[model samples]
Target: MASSMLKSAGEIQNLIFSQNQKLTHLARCGRIDEAVKLFESMPARNAVSWNCMISGLAKNGRVADARHLFDRMASKNLISWNTMIAGYSHNNRVLEASQLFDEMPKRDSYSWTLMISCYSRNGELERARWLFDSMPGVKTPVCYNAMIAGYAKNGMFQDAIVLLTEMPVSARNMVSWNSVLAGYTQNQEMVQGLKFFGEMQEKDVVSWNLMVEGFLQVGDLESAWSFFRATPCPNVASWVTMLNGFSKSGNIDEARRLFDEMPERNLVAWNAMISGYVQFLQIEEAYRLFGEMSERNSVTWTTMINGYIRIGKLEKARELLDSMPFKNVVAQTAMLTGYVQCMRMEEAVELFEKISTKDDFCWNAMISGYAHCGRMDKAVELYKRMPTKSLFSLNTIIAGHAQQGEMHKALEVFKQMRERNTVTWNSIISGLTQNGFYCDSIKHFVLLRNEGRKPDPCTYACGLAACAYLAALQVGKQLHLLLVKSGHVNDLFAGNALINMYARCGRISSAKQAFDEMASVDLISWNTLITGYALNGFGRETISLFKEMEVNGFRPDDITFVGVLSACSHAGLIDEGLKYFDSMSRDHSVERVAEHYACVVDLLGRAGRLEEAYKLVTEMPIKVNAGVWGALLGACRMHGNPDIAKFAAEKLFVIEPQKTSNYVLLSNVHADARRWEDVDRVRSLLKEIGIQKQPGCSWIDIKKKVCSFVSDDPMQPGATEVGFVLEMLCAHIRNTEIMPWSSLLDCG
Candidate 1:
């Protein structure tokens, strides 16, 4: 190249930029060999020539070659530096990018922003923030947008919003608007996201895409489609975003329609459609798409396997996994979780052992599987034996412990964690409340505040559940006030929790107020309030509320059925209960579970139709668990029919002979038949085996401290007062149809 550059001006066979342009075209076309041949023929080379070659090399992933070419350049200008920096940044060479940035002859705002963006792309968020603070105030929108996008990507929505607020609107650009809109979407503030989006009249492609993405983020598929229709032109991104929103919104038919109509399909578009089917539990559609894809990447394969796993089509997931030409941690974890979640623990462990490498996500995925499947021991064992720990892994195992009623162990892990974030705290609190450590969870909630940490919605949700568990209206009110003061009253988790707490504590009006005041309600919010209404014997109100939820465009899930079916049973609406069961499958596409069938049995049994209840249980597709059989048996006992009661009891006993309720229910059936000999035999068998019921317990939280009391235990702080309160409540309920037994447990 230098030898050719020694030619005289008259000997120059080509114009300077003409030759450079040809070289750029060659490089851009990835004809590196021919580009080099042309480069060597150049009579002269300048900074632009070197930058072009550098960019080509970097773009082609020849970062070392690009670096060598950069170093060998005789003179470098600002363009040269920017070009090289962009190449390294694009190639993900963050350290080299930072080195180049530090050594640049002159640094402008683009230089600063580009470097910051490099860090952000690499997920070095703290490093990006450091660069952001060091930027000079000629600070362009690019720089702030980079910082905002960085924050948003890392889930620091508040930080992103705060910076967006402090920055002047005059400095706003499309990138800036996109970042803020995306930040709001990621934080689940779809309304505000749209507000910011609609406010952007001077929009570009990214601007329009951001708004569509915001609607998609909140499962507002109709709104997203409306926007997509209104757009003058839609890009691959817009089409895919709309399709994905539809898919996730449980409109797989709409998703397929959009996918089929796409004019041009990129890999992203392909992945989105595949992922959309999986999200909707349309496993056949997802797998069909996966098979139809002529060119499938890791994402497509991973999506198909995950969809199959979620739908309990583990065989299909394994087949896809085995057939995949490319396998990664995501696929491996998906398979492992499939087995673990389905309670095939041995198979999951066998697969896990065969994997050579496991990332933090892999560990967490496995832990999550075990936790969800109720194999807490295995989950705990794996967590202890994990070679590495991440915040995700720790939080997952902590949540698993909480799920399994291992509050003490969960707290131990929380206390031992090197890094404790909000999720960790939330998991611990949730576990405590879920495991019946209500007082302890409430104490931890106060302790969290005392430690200068503000509770997120999940935290308040757990605390509110604790209050409900304890039936503490006073404590619930205080937490409510605290939530209002903290300005998180609109949070779905907090609102739902407050509703449950107030309803359970006999403050139904307050609960309704909290529920009505909520700006946005999720499925859980509706379920909580509906269930509260049912528990309060407001069956008509429960049904009406459920109807309203659907009218407002919310889909009812399994939990919703529990409330509605329970309402039906309590109100003797046998016909209504059966209608809901049919609708659950026919209209809502919700599969009827044994619990649902059990609710139907309870409804029939309460109406004194033991034969109908028995027929329904026998016709159930899945195994009727003890709960279902027990309901039928209880109905038999109520009707004083020993034959049917014995039948239901035998089924329940085979499932769990050791369950005290099964024995107690059998005894009651026999006693109702005047089978005194059988009742005595049952009493002797229980005493001989030393099988005793676990005592009922209650606890309270006072000023961030836990105090516990059992029905017969006297070690609690306010044992005497608790005993007195229980006796008084018992006396008050003595004249009611139901008997009061301090030690008796309610299955609900």
Candidate 2:
């Protein structure tokens, strides 16, 4: 019996030895599941075998399985307990890790440090600090480093600095210094980061890399280059950072130079260069780079798609998107965003539907596209169908409703928001102003400030525009003061709005002052100031501003030329107007739309060159609209040319038959020519069409409230007194030697 037992024991020992070897090999090779299976099938197990299996499962992120095996173990050593605790820590199950740690019969430095790292990784810095303070044994440098890094990562600069200063002399390390410096750099405090870096006793490669990244963040290529040259040995990240800095600064040439100079190019470096080309609108160059890449990722594919979309090459974007090996939400959304940008709402919707897993961004894009195309009803419908609603989704719905002048609907959406943001407030304020509820727009802006939501640039711009439309100069100035106090007066958007408001209020000097004070000027700034001058009848200032704009390296856009031509026409600069109109397509490459043609025709017709105006209209390349004919008819009235009036009136009857001005202008032209029969016929036609000329009215601002007056108006509060005063003034003028014209007297 003893001999049989000995033989079985020998066989079992051999089997156990072979299985242990196989399990170790599988775990090392990262075949963790196979290792676990091998472990489960074993008939006999030792302490080493159980520890190996538990460690393998924990290392492979199967923490639950590791814990199950641990609980089932009849006996466990300190290593087994530590392994289970570390597994929970690594998996971010901090509570379970802490519980296991408390129950441990013995504790190690590694066990405590793992728990600290776990808390830090999860952004629970306070909990991490408590564990560090209560640790029974000596604190490890690694544990201190983890806590400091967590503070820096969370932007707790003061707390991180406090810890760094209070740490034991031995705990101070390169990682501790780097974490704080990186915190400043990450927070966009590059200047402060530089000051801190200057005081560092010893700097490593990571320190140098961070300084380079900091300079690059602010687009300071010169500073970045100086730092790059100072780097002991630049890594791929350093090279990519420099490349990206140049790309964003619009220096494509410099970016390419850096790309070619890289000793070893990786996927990231290639992507940075490709994205640079995409940003600069060099689409063909981006495509070439994309094709040259040996490896491509999801970002690369999406970037190429975005490049095509920028240049209106939808076909190319579609082709590449279809051929992509994998399609993620980002790639799909890129195509969807392109459709929205191009105002192809239906196509955007179709693409949106094809995305099987639609996220909030995808839904927002479709909703915004519908709103942009003035399909608010469709936008609202899509908003309802959204399975989930984020703040952005709700804001989109409110903006769409606001954009279409549905104030009540916009308000309804605004009230529905459980957590209202500044964007929501801006949408309602801007919407009210756009829909001609200027007073309401300003009122909401005031309410926004009172509600503890400080206004952003959009809010200021919209409010200023409301003031401008209402000609409430006092209110505009008050908002301007608020903008100044807020330190956003120099922002391009707010500055542009200020200029527009001043200009629309006939305060040309104030508009020019705003324009002059701008630290940086964009196309909108120049256009706003010039348009303001033209609007207030400062024709010479508009022309002078245009010249200054050209001299200052500013190119005129379509709107700029519109302002220029309108100014020339208003000032009766016929030759100048014609010269600019001709040069629009030739010199500026600005194609003349119908509006420009109208300006040129008004100029010639107003200058008594009816024949020239008529010839220009007849020879215009584009289809002539009602404005062109209306100009000719107005000129006929001034010159008493009945022949041209009939021609213009006939076209107006077809193009804009319901327009009251066309009928009025034609009747005046016939009256000037003493063509009574034609006048009667035109007046009868107006009556048959049921077109009544709306009474001309003017508004005056009285202590912020607008008081309106119409010709022959009896709606004035003190009409009888006003009539008596007006009669006395007219009688006094007539009593003097200077007598009024017979036609003017009869009309009065």
* Best-performing candidate as measured by TM-score: 2
C-alpha TM-score for every candidate: 0.63, 0.70
**Roughly what TM-score does model 1 have, to 2 decimal places?**
0.63
Tens digit of per-residue lDDT, candidate 2, span 577-619? 7888888889989888888888888888888888988898889
Q: For residues 1-748, write the lDDT of model 1, one tens digit per residue.
A: 9987586665553577788899898776555656767877776877788888888777755666778888888888887788889998987778789998988889877788899999987778899989888888778878888888888876677787788878889987667767877777776677777787777656676667777777776556677777888877788988888887777777878888988899999888888988887787877877777777787766787888888888888998899899977465567788887887777878887888876556566777777878888777777787787764567878888888777777777888888886677888898888888888888888888777767677888888888899898887667777887788766788777888899999898777788889899877789888888988888888788889999999989999998998899888988777878889889989998887878888888889999998888888888889889889888988887887788887888787678868888778778888878999988877776777678877897777999997766776677666788778979989977766442121121111
Clashing pairs for model 1 are none
Clashing pairs in 2: none
Candidate 2 ranges beyond 4 A from true positions: 1-234, 339-351, 481-490, 695-711, 715-748
Ten contiguous residues minimizing lDDT sum, candidate 1 = 739-748
| Backbone clash count, each prediction separately | 0, 0
